[model samples]
Target: MATYIISSFRNHNKHVTYTSLISTSVNHTQILEEFHKFQYMQTKVFVVHGSPSISSRLFSMAKDVGMMSEGYTWIVTSKTTNFLKFMDSKAIESMQGAVGFKSYFPKSSKFHGLKHFMGLKEVDYDGMWAYDAVYALAMAVERLQTKKHVTKLALLDHILRTTFRGLGGEFKFVNERTLLRPIEVKNVIGKGDKRVGFSIVNGEFVKKMGKTNSSTNNGLEHIVFPGGHTSILNHRRLQVNGKKMRILVPVFGGFKNILQMVVDPKTNLSNVSGFCGDVFNVAFNVLNHKVDIEFVPYLFEEGRTFNDLIDKVYYKEFDAAVGDITITSNRSRYVDFTLPYSDMGVGTLVRNADKSIWIFLSPLNADLWFTSAGFFLFLGFVIWVIEHRTNEEFQGSTTQQIGTTLWFAFSTLVYAHREKLESNLSRFVVTVWVFVVLVLTSSYTATLSSLLTVQQIALKGGSVQFQGISPVKAAVYNNVKLNEDVLVELRSADDYAKALRNGRVGAIIDEILYIKSVLALYSRHEFSLVATSSTTNGFGFVFQKGSTLAKDISTQIAKLREDGTLKALEDKWLERQSSIMSNDFPAVSPNILNLYGLRGLFLISGVSMAFALLVSMVYLAREKCQGRSKMEMLRRVSKICPTPSTCTR
Candidate 1:
């Protein structure tokens, strides 16, 4: 059975680590110590092949070493699982959540009758095999008795050729030595076991154990692993045989909150702690098995880059590299990277706009402001023309009339105008005008409020610069279409702040991860994220090419994202620093509303005013022609149309 298991693993290109225990010579402490040594390798699966007594001892030791937990798997061979019914309750409890292989046989009426004859409630595989062996021998001896001369050789030949339907299926031998039997895969539950699937002759899982004979291939049904977990455990490869994995961490001095390495003087061991470190540690802890790791700090020397740190992983000098390493296409050619754990994009950080007294007019562009003013004046004139002859409010002096008109036009902005209209035409005009004013006022108020509370940033057509150790930063800068001569490069987060504040650089452009680090140091009121271009992938952990650990850790990162752990970590570290810059302040321009947007409102107001003026003129002309002839009425209408010369007078 052990050889078969080894061969199966070899077929799949998986490495197998084997160990043996002698029941007579190996003590309990020695076996436990051996299990303890395996912990350093982060072995997630274990296959046990031995007698029931030896398997029980191995399971007990495994539970002691903490291997029989949610993330671990234990598989026992038929030698032990076949006799699980006879094992004690203690031994059975220790093997809970274990997967086992047992010999399979179709039960028949004759098998039940034999059990009843023996007065036994249950019969194990061993008892069934013994019964079949005795029956075969008895039949062979009876056939030999019929022979004239019987010898030991003749008796053996008869036994070998014997074939019959026995309690344990067909009593037949294959190749004169091995039995042709199928194996049933079972999982240990509370003091018992349940069949999960079946393994055929080629070690392939062919069927699931259920009412439906659904065929399966290469895998079993859902398994309840240790701790009653239904999710499959992640299978990770060992970096070194039972040794602590060497991990390289960058010793960043500027953005310590992003990635930092500190050493303890007493123990002389490096301790990695920062936003990146915490994220990596959280993802590592949720893996199927814990790997022992040693953090070695790599101090950034002159001209050293993040690529150098990744090269160490590529060359096998370190098992992995954990930091704020940006995943780029160029770097990905030589090393593998886990899924990004941070926000992805390139952001432009610039100085906040200064508070101006004319900030209220900043929400709408000049064209919109002028268009709105013209509509207001036109509506005021239409109302005055419609009501001046009938309403006393419009019958004042020329100066008073002009003042009233202007007041009415602007008062509609706040819905505080108290003028009453006597004519239906005037009322219609005012109603439509009031609706237009309401919409304009609401939009203006909302925009002005946002501008007042949140600091706005305007990226003028100025020189752009980026600061980072990644070679991809240059590619991102070129993608933004900035002139090479105007590009300035800085080193640390402090440099970015100083350049932006002192007017050394107009705008600093980099990934959102590094831009956020700058925002954390300074007040958000002074600096703001102006624009974001999603031109680059985000930050990720680096590993050697084709390393399985990279895939395993990437899976864990995806889980963290789904379960909200990644967001919680972000809030704990990065979000708290820039909480003032919440969702209210998005990376958009303050001049959002324009003349084109309010064209519909202006059109409605203009049509209403023009209709009011036409109706008012027709009413006045009719009033004048009430007691006159057609010729006199025509003369009066002609008189109403003043000449250009009379206008000068």
Candidate 2:
């Protein structure tokens, strides 16, 4: 029967568990006390199966222990309820408000006659079954009397085949020997019981005969369960010792916008409000069960950490801990945590540096700048060699030629040069160089624009600071590599800003959520988040170790995240403080252009210049060979490439 109940629940996608409390020698009080050790909030429905004496005592003990309350349910099997008539009135009274199942037999003239013969006003199901067994044996004997054989085997065969409508509903064999009938679902009332429904052959409930008013969806009539409640009890109304659940929240000096506790002067009641509070409220609203909660604030002291706050839950001082509590491995050993609703990571908040006078050169590093300058000089020499003999623009003294060459090379950056090309070799070199210049100029412009618009800072080999109250500060120290002497502890956002402004600390290291709160509190433009490390889990609600409420609330938190409620809460509580900040200054630094990023463009330009120089040299060699006299060719070349001394004469 227990297996059937479990399977039926599983078929409907509902979880069910069966616990056996049957002890051979233990007293009823010991068994009941042992059962009380299980969490009532976790397990609601309990099915009791035993003889009438033991079950009656257990039912009375359950009522005394407050288990027969609004959030609990007690059920009994036919083993106890089938013989309820033999028990006294006190035993029946103790079973009040309990639901039980018993073998059902329809009322007929034969049933009444059997009850009258037994001299009893009411006959229980066991009495009816005995009457049906006697009637079936009589029918089998009559059938065998017609046959010549009176053997034991022949009598058993006749009994198996016999069918009749006796005191019981149907006195017939199904599947060769077993009789099947419906079971009545009864609610224990004043002195008797009420027929609420019937469990048919398939273990499904059907309304009692001639009853159309059903209170529950399971086709059962109105049931007065334990605690005299007419409606069904779900698991959500769990209480701690029959009172509201007490939750501990941290009331500290820093990051109050994330979590804060305020006391009303008149009422002396504490109210919690902030991003963490809003998240908890939203998650609680969507929970499957209803749980009353009370918020108790733990005043922060110098040496007390969040670990101490979580320890309160472990020691049973509070049912749970909720606030901006980080989930860490050390704390997880003592308590369970819900899924993190905030963003994870440690952020580095540093003061924005003043813009430098030479900010134009900030886009490219030294390697890229030096490489570009060298390529400019090389391309100028190559073009001059190719055009020196043929083009009049190239005919000049050494100083004049040097000035013109450098002018032509650098002018390609703006595409503004007066010199005209006479050789295709020189034009081809210029064309390729111009393309390379175009790519370099465009990259420089984009990178420089980002630097000018966004605040830039550096934080290498400088002192760091963090909130001393944060439990994850040690993790931040290990990730960012801070020394004992160089670490500064601050308590508030204003202190963080003051320390950075006066150069007391180079960077402030903390969780991303706390860093964001600091940015929102002050002028976000003055401070920027430059670096981040994913070293710790974000903030979550805390519960006692092995508490099922933690898992239930975690499921609700996930749903809130998926539906965007969590984001809306963040914007309302956290993002609104920094409404003046724009999307231009993100939480990370912009990428800087380097020599490695433009290596291919420089490679293409170098190859083109080399090819042009080779072609020009080969053409000049052929022309010199075609000249009639070597002296005449020499005179021509000397006139084109005059020395600085000759140009002065």
State which candidate has the highest TM-score. 2
RMSD per prediction, one decimal? 15.0, 10.7
Q: Please report, in order, the local distance difference test score of every candidate based on alpha carbons.
A: 0.78, 0.78
- Candidate 2 has an lDDT of 0.78
Weakest 10 consecutive residues of candidate 1 by summed lDDT? 209-218
Show the lowest summed lDDT stretch of 10 residues, model 2: 576-585
True-structure Cα RMSD, model 1: 15.0
Off by over 4 Å in 1: 1-254, 261-273, 278-318, 327-352, 462-489, 503-512, 528-538, 545-548, 551-591, 615-649
How would you encode candidate 2's per-residue C-alpha lDDT over 33-59 as one tens digit per residue?
Answer: 566654433455677778888887777
Per-candidate TM-scores read: 0.54, 0.67
407-483 per-residue lDDT for model 1 (tens digits): 98888888888888788888788889889888888899889987886566554655666765765457665686666
